[model samples]
Target chain A: MVKSIPLTKADVLHLLSEIVDPEIPVVNIQEMGMLRDVLLSGDSCEVLLTPTYNGCPAMGIIEQDILLLLQQHGIPNAKVKLVYAPAWTTDWMSDSTKEKLKHYGIAAPLHSSCVNWLKPDQITVACPNCGSEETLLVSRFGSTACKALYRCNGCKEPFEYFKCH
Target chain B: MTLQEALFNYLLRLGDNALIQGHRLSEWCSKAPVLEEDLALTNMALDQIGAAQAFLKYAGAIENKGRSEDDLAYKRAERQFFNNLMTELPIGDFSFTIAKQLLLSSFEFFLFRGLSQSKDQTIANIAAKTLKEVHYHLAHSRDWCFRLGKGTEVSHEKLQNSVNALWMYTDELFEMGEADEVLMEAGIVFSLKEIKPKWLELVSGILDDANIALPNVDYMQTGSRKGIHTEHLGHLLSEMQFLQRAYPDASW
Candidate 1:
């Protein structure tokens, strides 16, 4: 007879937090709030994930990362289900992650309730280089789908801001 | 007309548009002008294919024929396809392809926006989901149109010629036949009469911004909605359905 070790949601969440987003290396799955729910039943585990955007290319890579992480911890048969009804927004990001983004030379997203319109009020996006809010959006779309191109007036350097869709 | 039949026809049109345009865009997979553009075009193609799959699957269920999306996409004859003629035209050159994209994406943006408010919940949901990508596609194509139309003299001339060649085909995009009328009456689909003016204004404004002149050609050809397609559609169908025709049950 084979014995299975008991694991709780906390244990699963801890394991999941170690998984980082492939695109933004500094942020982990927990920081991105992509880890919605984790459930365990016997030897199998079920995970609920929300995509950053529809048709996001990073989804496939994120799924693979989840499987590898859980399997490495001796838990096989982990299933990841994508939920699309309650679309993801930057508001779901953790406070610590927001702070870390600023520290890592990237401006964190602003809280905007309006749809289809970029934030009208020029909220300070602390310069990723000089830690100043003097930055301007150069283009709405950037190199990647999740980012927007912005030039920091303080540092006079261009950087990518993870857009708050 | 019955609701089920209307839904069937409506979904079929949506599926055909996506599948045909997806096929055309896929041709630029490795042939885009720049590396970023290559990926962008392929990404848009993948989005269209995904939307086609979703719409076709819903169509099969409404038809109650046990036909899968692939069955509908691959097995249907040219006359059975309900896509606009604009999508079936050949990709002549880089300039021509960009011009076609600029026109088609703008039309789709307006069409899908109205569709997001459709009475049919399934169609509405899919349209809302797909509109975000369509919005980006329009922006990308519009930016390119301006660059190519206002760039070097050669590029400007080539892009202008491409736009003129494609202008006559734009009328076919807003042609509403019996199926369209039935769906429009049921509020399942929006009327093209309402959609046409906005489409024309947006497209014309983009061309004007690029310093490109709109063709004065008033005579237009229209037949794709009623199953009468251009000479180009048959060749496109043959190439698209070749593998499926050769091996009926082939699986990836």
Candidate 2:
């Protein structure tokens, strides 16, 4: 008979790294900085996560995914808690992840959201579709909370810009 | 009031406004003038609901009540609710929704910005996060104000009426309670008096550019902070609370 191994913190981390963001499949939760900490004590386990957006529906899915992955890995006493202290920021997103987002046809943020908000007109975003410098913001909101709709003047294609925030 | 009570009341005000306002915006689903507008309103609704959850959850904890965020949102009566009356009022028209969004989003922008500086770390964190979302909502509605305001005579008239009709409720947004004084003194909350000027300046600036006149009204509608609300809030609560009230503790 095969025996189930008790889940270690390293085991949990390795399993969690496999979980991709439900909305943006290209990036894993680890890459997005959603996985804050995972603690394993005896049979109990707790995972702390920070929300990237206040109303991002992906949070529920991510929580469920975490638990399912843990359960499948032979861990039963596990829970996910959402934390708000210090909040979440696009700055925490890595440059490599931004490149991955651009490859997925969504333009990455051009600057830190903290500094860009006041000088919105001065900030420019290149088109992820055509890589054009001339892109006009179609709307502040697009298909989701974290992205804005933009139209490329060069290619005339509309694409989503993962907003500065 | 003790420090905890003041904070609880303050959080209830924050949560109720977002809860009621988000419901009003959700009504625009499948009904907005355009697909983009539909998405915009609903997106804003989702953000507000998320904010409401955070505030209410904190409020519940502060009150030392076993009530969860869902309980505060779903089980509370209308008079028990403290959302600004303007939020509970019906979604009048496309122009009216835009106008209300402009006013509410702008108020939230300044309000949250001030709150980001709160001495309370949790409130500060939520405010900072919410401010980012409200920034987009404000810009979205502000752009529409320009379009509908300058587009055509009929559109302009509708937009003007919305702005004027909503002016009366604007005063209640800045009303400070004795409880708020407790938090304000402790540096846990910002002064609404300080925010009112910033709100007025932003609102008037947009109205000026949109060619809409600021409403001239002597008597502004107040109360709602203390649970006194318009008749519309009762009706809104009936719809929002129906499923939860019918099936107590029911969950998927």
Candidate 3:
């Protein structure tokens, strides 16, 4: 009889890194920091996820994808739980993913500590296209709930800024 | 009422407030003055709906009933709902919506801040998560109030009228009843008395910045906690509940 090794936490992490966020195709859940923790005991795997935003529509899809990916990896009894403690912040997003987001034409979130949502007018978001600091907020919300719409005064192009929460 | 029952009722009030207000905001999805503003309002609506689901789900669990969030939201009769009267009012115009947002978001900003420290872990968790969204919502409406209040004669008149028209229902926001008192005793809920002063201060500061006068009113509307609502709520419920009423157990 041939014996197969059970999946470890590192193995689970490696698999999760492949699951792309349906909303932002360029970034995976791991890179987005939505995948918080994984507990694997035998074949019963448990995954904990935190939504990037409280009402993020992508949560359901991400949960399903994680389950399917785990199942495909021969862990059929995996459970994905959504938690909201120490709440998910833009600061969790990896630098590489932020670069990928900017390259994808959606300006990534500024570091959480640097964001002052209260004084939005005082905050300057450089345009992804022209790299100009003269972008004006067209709206506090954008195409997605987690982003803000901004128009570049220099480039004269409208773009999405991944807002800090 | 027993402590459990009181807590259940309290949760309904919180959930219903969010659900009804979210429904009203969704009405502006395609009708906003600008596309960006349309998205913003709808996004806020989504946030409220999500919050409502969390609260209602918790309420159902506490009731020890088989009911789910949808069952509580769509299956409840108009009289069974406990949302505030301000939430059921029609979204008359941009300024009207802005005026409503200003009042409710300010109220929620403080309410959630208090609830975040509640003895109940579930309530505290939900409150802490929601407070983040409420912060942005308040800021959005506050800035708009400033812009519209100082924009032009027509804009200022519209906003001022909105404030006056809605002021009658504002008092009911702080009207705590037996359920609230019971929950307050249990530390499951906090007194609105504490939130009232902070609410007034924050709202007044925004109104002052907006150059809008505070409405001078005496006779205030009430009864939402007891499920007594304006005529508008029934109509709103009929439209909102239409889908679930027609196709039971439908899911995407």
- The DockQ of each candidate is 0.20, 0.65, 0.61
Estimate, for each residue in A1-165, the C-alpha lDDT of model 2 and write its tens digit.
Answer: 434448678888889999999888999998888899997776678999999888789999999999998889888768998988667777778999999999999998765743555336567789988888898987787888888888999999999988777
RMSD of each: 4.6, 2.3, 2.1
Task: Score every model by TM-score.
Answer: 0.78, 0.95, 0.95
Query: Can you list the residue pairs that collide in candidate 2?
Result: none
Ranking by lDDT: 3, 2, 1
lDDT of 3 by residue, B96-207 (tens): 9999999999999889989999999889988988988887798789889999999999999999999999999988999989998888888988889888988989888889
Query: Candidate 3: misplaced stretches above 4 Å?
Result: A1-5, A115-118
Least accurate 10 contiguous residues by lDDT in model 1 chain B: B34-43
Candidate 2 CAPRI category: medium
Reference-based lDDT, residue A138, model 3:
83
Clashes of each: 1, 0, 0
Off by over 4 Å in 1: A1-164
For each candidate, what is chain B's TM-score? 0.96, 0.99, 0.98
Worst 10 residues of 2 chain B by lDDT: B32-41
Please report the candidate that would top DockQ against the real structure.
2
lDDT of 1 by residue, A1-165 (tens): 544636788998998988888878889887897878997776768999976655566888999999998888887778998764354667888788988887776677766454343123344556667776788866545566666567988879988776665
Superior candidate under lDDT, 1 versus 2: 2
